[model samples]
Target: MTAITGTVYDSSGQPVEGVNIQWSSNEDPPVSSHERGSRTIDDGSYRLVLHRGSWDVHGTKDGTGTEVETVVLGADDAVVDLHFP
Candidate 1:
């Protein structure tokens, strides 16, 4: 598994709390049930352990809009930040 970490931020560059973070595998013949989710902590920081593969990660809040990023994980971990406008 690969460890993914990052912080969620608003348009003004402030950390956002309680943002929902979800991800799903994007590999060919996609793995079944290869999806997971988490929420940001008080510091707008979040972490997820995902299998090595291509995946689409999404972040969203009640009214702050949603952000999506595509990540490819191999042997090394990755950091992906999300921004909402």
Candidate 2:
């Protein structure tokens, strides 16, 4: 298992707070029974723990969102930032 941490930004390059960071994996599932979501706080930062595999990470607020693909190696953490239009 590894911890993935990052921030979300808007189109104007401002931090986005109170947004939901959702992630799903095709090659590996969650390491535990935890849900696959992390919400950004006032600083737009979030952390999610996932097993080693490829995942599709997404950020969403209201009805708009953006997604990116990332891979995590065994026992290594990752950082993936997302930007929305």
**By TM-score, who's the top model here?**
1
Q: What is candidate 2's CA lDDT for residue 10? A: 90
Task: Look at candidate 1 and give me any clashing residue pairs.
Answer: none
Q: Which stretches of candidate 1 lie over 4 Å from their true place?
A: 32-36
Q: What tens-digit string does per-residue lDDT give for candidate 1 at 1-85?
A: 9999999998899999998888877888875333236899999999998889888887878855557788999999999998996
For each candidate in the order shown, give its overall lDDT on alpha carbons.
0.84, 0.77
10 residues in a row with least lDDT, candidate 2: 28-37
Q: Which regions of candidate 2 are displaced past 4 Å?
A: 28-36
lDDT by residue (1-85, candidate 2, tens digit) is 7888888999988889988888776564443332336799999889887777767788889878866646555678888888896
TM-score (all chains, Cα) for each model:
0.88, 0.82
Clash count in backbone of candidate 1: 0
